[model samples]
Target: MSELVDLRTSGRTAVITLRRPAKRNALTIELCDLIRDAATGAVADGARSLVVTGEGTSFCAGADLDAVYGDTFREALYGMLQTLTTLPVPVVAAVNGPAIGAGTQIAIACDVRVAAPTAAFAIPTAGNALAVDPWTIRRFSLLAGNGAARAALLGLEKIGADRAHALGLADRLGDLDDALAWAAQMAELAPLTLAYSKQVLNTVFEPELDAATAAELGKSFDACWASEDFAEARAARREKRKPVFRGL
Candidate 1:
C-alpha cells in the first residue's frame, strides 16, 4: 500500500487516514487507489465497521488540480468512492477540518459524518469550470438537500460544521475520537442486519443509471475534463493567480 494512505484496526473497527498533511491530504490517483485497497484489506481482515479521517488539520482539501484532468484519475477517484459506499461494513467520516471538492464527496460516500468545529464542506467545481459525476450530485442532494447542494455546487459557498449538521450533511458534530467511538459501537451490532440495511439504502436511493443517461452524463463529464478552462484553472493555481474561466 502507498504510504500516503494508512490503514489500521481498532478492535473490529478499521481506520483509514490520509497521511499527506503537507498537501492537506489532497486526493491523487495513487492515493485513491491505495484507499480502495486499504478498504478492501480491512474487509478481508474481518473489520465490522470503518472510520476514515485525515492525519492532519485538513480532512482533504480536494483532488490535486495538477493531476485532476484525465480518465485515469477520474476512474481511480470514483472507484474509491464507490468502493467505500458499497463496503459491507458501515463507514463513518471524521471530518477533522475543511473538506473541499473531492473531500466533500469522500465525506458523503460514508454512511455517516462526524464533523469537527473546524470542518467545512465545499465543491467549487463550477468556479473552475469543472464538474463532478452525476452520482456525486445525486448523493450529495440526497444526504444534504437540494437547497444545500445548490448552495455548495452553484453558489460555491462553504458549509461549516454547524450548518452541515443542521442541513443533515453531518450526522453529528464531533472529532476523530467521537467517530471512532461510533464506529466501535457499530462494530458490536448484528453484522448481517447492518449489511442488509446498507445494501437496501444504497439500492433504493441510488438506482442504476440507464445506458442513454449514463452515456450522456459521461460525455458531459469528459467534456469538462477536456475543456480549456480546466487547464487554465490548473495553470492559474501554479501561477498563484485566480483562474479566469472561458466556458469553452
Candidate 2:
C-alpha cells in the first residue's frame, strides 16, 4: 500500500491522487515510484483511461526539497515521467491548481491536460539555477512556441490556465471532476486504436540526442544543481523574499 498516493478506479477510469496536501503534493522518490506502478497497474486492472490529480489545491508543487535536488531524485522523476507518457492507456492531467517546475513536466507528459481556473504552470529553472533535460526543453518549445518556452525557462514567468490554453499547453479549463468526466468519456474509445495513435504521434517528431549531446546536457544539469545560485534559492525560499541569483 502506498502511503503518499491514492489509486482508486471508477468504471474504466483509474484516478491517482497525490495525497500529500501539506507539502503541496511535492514528488518524493517513493511517491514517484508509486505513481509509475499505479500507471502500469491501472492499465492492468482494466482501466482504459487514467486521471492524475492532487488531493487539494495544488496539483503538484514540483520536487520535495527535503529529498529531491540529487541525481537519484532526477532518475526516479524521469522514470515516472516516461511511465506517464508511454503507458498503453491515455493519461489525463487534472491540474486543479499550481503545477510548478517538475510538476509541469508531469502534466506535459500526459496525453491531455484540463486545468482549473486556479491552476497555473511554471518552470522556474533559472531562478534555482537548475536545468531540465534536452527532451523536456524541446517538448516545451514545441508545445507552446519559443517565446512562451523562453518565458518559463529563462524569465521564470508563471503561465496561468488561460494563457496556457491559448498557448496550446493546456487542452481545456475545468476542475478535477470535469477532468474525470472527460476521462470517462475517453474510456469508451477503442483501446488498440488509442494505443497505436499515441505511440505514433508521440514518437513521430521526437529527436534523439547523440551520445555527446546527452552527456553534455547531463553535465550541465549537474553543474547547475550544484551551483551557488541553487543554494541562494533555497535560502530565499526560507527567507520569504526574492532570490538574488549570481551567475557563479
Candidate 3:
C-alpha cells in the first residue's frame, strides 16, 4: 500500500509530507495516525528538526468531516491532536496553500509556521454546526489575539498568508524550499541545547494557555523522555555516530 504520508531525512532534519492531494490533504484518521507515528519516529531517529508540508496545491483543507461527526471519531481526533503537540524536535509547518479548520489546528500545533504567498488560513466551524474544542479556542485566542480569534470562530473570516503573518498566525512568509533550508540550519544546533530551549519557551507560553490544555500538550514531551529515542540520542553522541531510533 502507498504510504499516506512521506518521510525523508537529510542530515538531522526530518521532512514529513502530507501526500493526499486529491483530498486537498484533508486529515483523515489514518493520516493523523501516520503523522503522529512519523513525528515520534523522527525524534527516535535523533532528528533535531522537523518540517511538515503538503504535496500539492493545498497544505490541508481541514479534517475529513465524514469522519469527524461521529462521537468515536471526535475522540480519535482529540487523541491525534494530543499526539501532535508532544513531538520532541522543533516542528515547522511549511504551508504551501490553504489551511482551514483542522489544518489551522495542525499548523498551530507546530513550533513555527512558514507560509507561501499563495497560502490562506481560515476557521469556518461556526456555520458548519461545529465548535472548536476548548483548548483550540484558548490557544487560537492566545496566538492570534482575542479579536482575530473571535473573527475566525464567529465571523468565519479567512486570512491570507501575508495577513496571517502580520496577525502572528504565521511566523514567516516563505515557500517549501525556504522552510527546508531553515530546518537544515536548525538541525546543526546542539541537540540538548535545542531540546532544552524548546522546553523553556514552551514553559513561558504554558501559563498563557489553559492549565488542562497545557497539561495535555505536555504528554508528548513526557513520552519522548521515556522513549528509547532519548537513550539512543545520548549513545549516538558518545559514539560519534547517528542514532537509529525505533520509536519505542
The residue pairs that clash in candidate 2, if any, are none
The lDDT of each candidate is: 0.94, 0.88, 0.79
The Cα RMSD of model 1 versus the native structure comes to: 1.1
Pairs in clash, predicted candidate 1: none
lDDT of 2 by residue, 148-246 (tens): 998888889999999999999999999988899999998999999999988887888665678998898888878888888888888888888898988
Error of 3 at 25 (Å): 0.8
Q: What is the lDDT, from 0 to 100, of the residue 141 in candidate 1?
A: 95
Better of 1 and 3 by lDDT: 1
lDDT of 1 by residue, 23-136 (tens): 999999999999999999999989999999998899999998776758899899999999999999999999999999999999999999999999999999998877999999
TM-score of 3: 0.79
Q: Per-residue lDDT of 1-248 in model 3, one digit per residue for the tens?
A: 13679999878889889999999999887888788788788888788899999889999999875555344645665676666666657788999999889888888878789999989888876444444566677677777888999998889989899888998988899998889888888888777787787778666765455678668765653465456665666566568787776767
Q: Can you give the TM-score per candidate against the true fold? A: 0.97, 0.93, 0.79
Where does the lowest 10-residue lDDT sum fall in candidate 2?
201-210
- In model 2, the number of clashes is 0
